[model samples]
Target: MSKPVTDRLLTALQAIQESQGAVSDTALKALSQARSEPLYRLEGLRSFYPVFREIAGAPHRLQICRDGPCRLKGQALAADLQVALDGRQDLDIEMVSCLGLCDCAPASALNETPGPLPDASTVIEWLDNAHWPIPVATNNLQRLPTDPYPGVDCRYGAIKAWRDRPAEDIIREIEAAGLQGLGGAAFPTARKWAFTRAASGEPRTVICNADESEPGTFKDRHLLENAPHLVIEGMLLGGVVIGASLGVIYLRHEYHQARRRIEEALATARGSGVLGPDARGPGLAFDIELFVSPGGYILGEETALLEALEDRRGEPRHKPPFPTTVGLHGGPTLINNVETLAAVTTILARGASWWRAQGRGEHAGLKYICVSGDIKTPQVLCLPWGSTVAEAIEGCGGLSDGRNLLAFSPGGASTPFLPPTAADTPMTFDDLRAAGSGLGTGALFVVGTGRSLADVLLAQAHFFRNESCGKCVPCRVGSAKGVEMAESALEHSPAPIEQALETLHHTLSRTSICGLGQVALLPLVDGLRRFPDEPSLKPLKGFTTGAD
Candidate 1:
């Protein structure tokens, strides 16, 4: 029999964590000896990833989100619930960063099974009775424009149609469609493929970055669960174009439901000759694998993800030779987000003109946006590119409880918050950026009146601070200190804290190695700049724009 693959350290660690509820010292010692790896390396991994634990805790564990969306919904819900269930012997309750289920604000995961946070009494009752709460259904997939074969059998039609065509032809169509990376970078999709194909490499890699852990972002999860076939076909086409034999979907760990759907779809594809040896043609070989992340927001960063896949701590690498030229295993890697790859299948199946017509004005193709926070009906919507923020809010049934809009986060936590006057801004990257914000990951977090702007802004900073991998000094110290200064500004005088934050933001923006630190203090800085006259923000007046 073939020997088991001992090189997959992260996979082995995940298996141990899954079966034992924690990676105890005993288990790590065994793993170190079995894999012939040092103990310090395993310890580093356990400390870096939040998913890994050194020892098991209470029998039942409940992790509640303490990020932007959940705070907006109910700032004290988690704390109150904790107090109500205090001194419990059998259960443990902890607040964590975004659960990536922002649509269900005040979300909780009971023993890693996510659901809406019920009353404390209900939880206590479940603990006493040993009856676990059923996880809320997360498979609310909507029909999106990117799905070319809607409600029909997914027979890998796009790949079959373009299989025999020249790679140049497929690249040209994608270029004509004006496709760009939808994962906030906005790099040209065709250019990335061309660079990888031309680069001097033997086995290029294609990665679908499904690790969308940004606060208020869950559209990728929706697509993976609903339209897995489209994403699979897109990856296969990319492999064929770039001569890559291996592709991986680096999915986040909390997305258990989406993971199931992807696995089912991958099995169907492999069984039908769409993936495997000779899958691309007579001589070409290509197949895709699903790599669940150990757990961290930094792993969503491209190079950081590369580090994790290679069985190391997830930390972003410096740029000079980008991933397209030098990537996974030191080979050319084409890394695109879930939305970008799924759209590729549509662009190639239907002509480029049809794809262009799906947008409004100058923008091309549809956009998947996750709308959450203070909205009446928080959900994911696949709208035409250039749709205004007001339109998206309308689709979500407007502000919750008939409250008037005060300010809005145009995108995920990294994006700056824009005032209500900017509600008419188009959701495109250029338009939102022109308005002093960005469509980062296309996550819209609505904030209605009466909400504490300072609380919301500080919550965002705390998230970046908490999720920082501490790989570099700038991000490690700066994020934590920035959060401290922001929190102090609320209680103490804001005069001294404003200048300190400005200088710190300047330092982080210039010296940080990755985007996580670069945009760590952006929300607070932007809130102070944009809402200087608001009651909650008046103490921090005269704030200048520095970090963007």
Candidate 2:
């Protein structure tokens, strides 16, 4: 007979504890024997969990960006080589969301190698020499047609269509659809539901994190505006899965249009029995309410979002007691990104394996990417995971002036830049990480010719400085110092600029508590590294330092 999973986990934990953090190979083997089921269960722990399945051999998994910005900057080609070589059966192939590495455009990776490179040159050299394979490339995958129901009222369209379906069936369909979260993390939806269902001691709560604060990413707003019902259905389904009676749509304040649309949709869903008690026939008792967030980039972080929901100042909390375990007024809460939950409706409506088969291998499914900056049509494009960045750009009618691309942010402002030399890499998570950047939120900010790298860094620095929540010391003081240094550099004080940059980099990267501070420094650091020829100092127009 097989040992119970919990017992196995306990045994493994005991061995690890006894070894003082260094379990022997034999102990590790025993642990692995015990870990099989937990690992499977853990696979669906969240969107980011399963992607690491392939990289379990390595101590860490690095996800890079091969989306629009990285592609325009030649990350696609580099990613392609990595995918081909790393696509072996033993290795995992994942196409992650953007990692805010557009400044380092054609980035590549050295996964689980541990320790930072001595310098940027060494990192680049290591990437250049890495043995990457040439993945089987394709042009572009076809997009699913928007399924807007005909003759249905705008408010009731989503609810009416799903009204007749059993909540369990809907949830099961979602589970079978193999839909992962789309909010950059790509967590499995079914697993989130299962965890929330089991973990919640009281009535569970569902929150849709619409705080799309990542610069260069606006796909959530598009979904909220155009397909509010889809998002609602997803939330409702989550409520059912977790036995929740209430749901909240936490949207950012700047998304006024989306908020309005969602409000109307909520009213329609409730009035028409798509939501509310006895929704859509009998035994369905779930409803969603809309709440607008006072806009701040930090509020988009999961824990911060929860705090904001509780009417507290928006700031992150310590984890280990993750949101899934305890959240939202000290109850078990399930929070999902706007895009991630939207995909849930489709998953529940469709079958998981069917959804899995929709895209190219590794990047197996559609990814809706928000392409902005330097493009003629800055619109959302839904394509398969393995599609190249060149394909997306061409599909969007190429750059505005056909100018040479300088750098692009594949994952938003925090992501490093990718130059135009690596444009053919596959847009898979593994491929992107192998390239050197991350596939963070799929926001592609393209930088074109004539844009000063220094100016870009300063602008981004100003944003971080303004958005710092004054919570942790690193972010609070580092962002302020960074802005001061950036301004001084703009006024020709190179020493202060360098000092500020170094301090900000260490504080944000090494000590900050959340993804916000860590990623916020990408553009600033990469700008200094990539644009050596660009003037680091600008003369002050009216000041004479010698006279002063």
Candidate 3:
């Protein structure tokens, strides 16, 4: 009936799932009686989240990524693996969405341990030997611009430097640096903190959204794994500015490496008096807790994340009593993503002028770009803001196998894919927006020649469709319908496809409750409008019925 019950519910369910392989009927009944909650509520959670199951699953589960970069690299990996291991009763192979490891194309997790997919023989060998390869934290912190302590031990200097100063001054410094939400929302970071601080509510909370679940976006994961101290310091700084004692990091469950790093960082901070009851001296209490999500892409949406914490189905809530004013447990909440919070620490540790000067041209500050798909070297690059998309491609060693660039999605899946001509566009919010796609999460998904634009575009649309929370009608039905129409267009031909998709996109954008619904069909809808002359799009327009 209260916060404690709600907070422990997901954890308890997870524990049950882990210990027994699933949440059984008798277990749910026992939990309902103990917590005094309705059985239907518990049932709703089990049905909504992908992590929970009604019955025991195979002991060893292999979930292979079938979205975006992974799909482009090896669309048949999961299927082929399934075919190879067909008779194994001890294991189950499932095709899943992104694993936040797009850099390692054709990513898969064996029994919740993530790694790049290997051949069936090697995997079987590992299973036989009782050894599985897992993702390890990459040691590239010194290369990133946002790491204030690059080569040295993190000292939490930012908090000590600004903890005693007026909160307004800290806000002014962040605003002067022109810091915006790096999670693709692009909301001004200073404005968010100020609003949350000014709002009248006790237990005002600060949250770092570590759930970067989109297919082409993994920069946040990199930050969480490599520069966790910066993230922790940033959230502590937020707690100081917002006058909040409690902070939560809503991390996606797939990031096993990141979870360990963050937990270690949190423990280190607490031991050093950087977080806890008297974190910044007496009367100023602040601490952060890491909350791993049960698993869902929609939970990346802020409101949907809140719903999960409240022990409800992870569905997006309607806005306009936004989280800044009415957040967790009816208190004002300040939520920023992993990269955004890390930038906060860097901006504060260094001066605002120093941060502003880090960018190229008129843009301000540094940006982390996740470059993948058809690139010679798939990786994350921390570049100055306003660096052109062409520069990003070059940094990733250009197109794979000397192939020419056909198109590129400047941001993640929700952003529209632009033609090769748009490569020179600067990697800023307004610049990318002007070039026909927004700088979404600073992710660049490049498509090389000889690849089917229709297939690539359809995959992006299907990602959204698969991740939709099904709370609202437009998103749930429209996303599915969009995928269906695109599939039919690719298989056969449809003349009204363009017009129908445009109408559907319009309806979803205007009527859908959250961003998940609003931008579900953006890739396909925009591709139809932008790439009329492309050979792959001809079938979608009913001009040709031949294969792409």
Candidate 4:
């Protein structure tokens, strides 16, 4: 129970007008109504919002993936479900980007609640166990065989404010929640906020990093499209704790709908007095703005994103002035990923103990996983941290065509591969890291029997080679050499292939400027090590081992 922005703004306006002397009530009401109209209209623009609000008391959204790899794996079921549930007055279904759960095609959410089916063997089991009967259609719009949220109250009651009331208290609550950044890097969010708070300055700024251009990842795009207000709330709370006056959401260009939703949400937040000039209760004021990125994967990196915001070329800058100190036109700015920011609002709304109470072991909370690749229902699966890969596959209705799960990328293309034997490992950053891969963005790409390891390596290498910004020589030259080596390996002997891969791996990992160059050889290196039998380098008729 927070006061509506419109009411707060009206009160502020009244006070300002009284201080200035007498003003006509009709004129004041007209201005207030006019300001409020835009937000209402924007809310009405999306048919999903009103229905979601009716049931969840807010815009509760479920984003089902509909991107490239997902589409290849029959993810369109989510879009069909979206159409069927469009005007349902109970649920909001949206076609989201990759959702990082590409390996679990056709994922959906219940309200803003995250996770796979709490407990159920199949789709029918979920529907039968639910309080309400699920809508069923045999056609393309068939409901997913998993419960979006189970054993949890779909009602907003789960989000209760803490008894302690102070900005610092709120920050401490977030710290205790054990929430980590979900935008590829698993850095502690509380520490990130602490940096900004400790920085020497006034008028600090917070930026929501929605520029999700990572290949094979798209959870942020879905969050932006479906729950822009959540992101707004998160930024607002971050601003409140750290004393930031301004907040900006830097979005990627390719996400046109996400940008639109965010712009609309910002307008709603401003007009309603939830953001800008005079927002919410007394002694609290923060404003939010939107800045679209120029659409590049490199821009997703924090330094490059800051540079892009200043209208400069989106390239990595040298750190140690690290964003917390000299960031965004030289100010103490805190930038967090979209998912990380969204989690902050949840942390504030629900106590730190509540968030901490979710997951087990070292993870300590839930993770919003985006599954892609050759899975039956590629979508975003929000599972409690430490859930096994087998559980994730089951959440997505299992693999398509009963194909054997050959190998999978635990993170994005930048991370190393994990063979089927590793699938049983828990899907947490620490666990994945221990298993020789980092959960970089929680992007899972499942490769089946027919998919060649060498081909996959070549495709991923080409992507890195194409995306390298050429700011540093190691990345530019190394990625090219890596691609060349990978392609050459396809037609050469085992020794030549080994030599080329070793050379590329050494240069890329040791001499690169940023994480991009440093990890560019991951796919090749990991694939070679894990699946030695797959890379059969046979010499072509006239080709020699050392020949160009």
Better of 1 and 2 by lDDT: 1
lDDT of 3 by residue, 1-548 (tens): 12443357898898889888999999999989988989998888889999998988677888889999999998876678888999987788889999998988878888888778877887788778888765542434444567777553556988889999999999999999999999999999999999999999776888899989988899988888888889899999999998888889999988888898899989998888889888755877888878889999999999999998888899988888999999887889999999999999999999899999989978899999999999998899999999999999999899997799999998999999999889999999999999889998888999999999989999999899999999999999999998998888788655558989999999999999999889999889899889877887887777774534
lDDT of 4 by residue, 490-512 (tens): 65533345556776788778877
Q: What is the Cα-based lDDT of residue 162 in candidate 3?
A: 92
Looking at model 2, residue 247 earns an lDDT score of: 83
**For candidate 3, which ten residues in a row score worst on lDDT?**
134-143
Model 3 clash pairs?
none
What is the alpha-carbon lDDT of model 3 when measured against the actual structure? 0.88
lDDT of 2 by residue, 1-548 (tens): 11222343333333353344333344445555655543332222211211112213532233444443444454445565555546343333333333332323333334522111123344334445664332211112222333333334543343455556555665566666666666767677767767777784664788899877665676777677777777788777677666677787877654545766788878877787778677634775777767655446777788987775653456789786887878877777889887777776555444466567777875556777777667776667777778877777777788877776776667666667676765676665566666666567877677788665556566666666667777888888877777776676466554434545766687688888887777666677666665544443232222233222
TM-scores, one per candidate: 0.96, 0.67, 0.97, 0.70
1-548 per-residue lDDT for model 1 (tens digits): 11122447888998998899899999999999988899999988888898898878898998888888987885577778989899988888888888998988878899888877777888988888888865574966666667788555655788989988999999999999999999998989999899888888755888999999999999999899888888999999999888888898999999999999999999988888889888789888888889999899999999999999888899999897888888988888989999999999999888899999989988898999999999999999989988999999999999998799988998899999999999999999899999999999999999999888878888899999999989899999999998887666666755446667878988999999999999999888877777867677655553322211
Error of 3 at 327 (Å): 0.5
Task: List candidate 4 segments past 4 Å from native.
Answer: 1-165, 280-284, 491-495, 535-548
Regions of model 2 farther than 4 Å from truth: 1-178, 280-284, 495-503, 530-548
RMSD of 2: 21.1
Off by over 4 Å in 3: 1-7, 134-143, 150-154, 493-495, 545-548
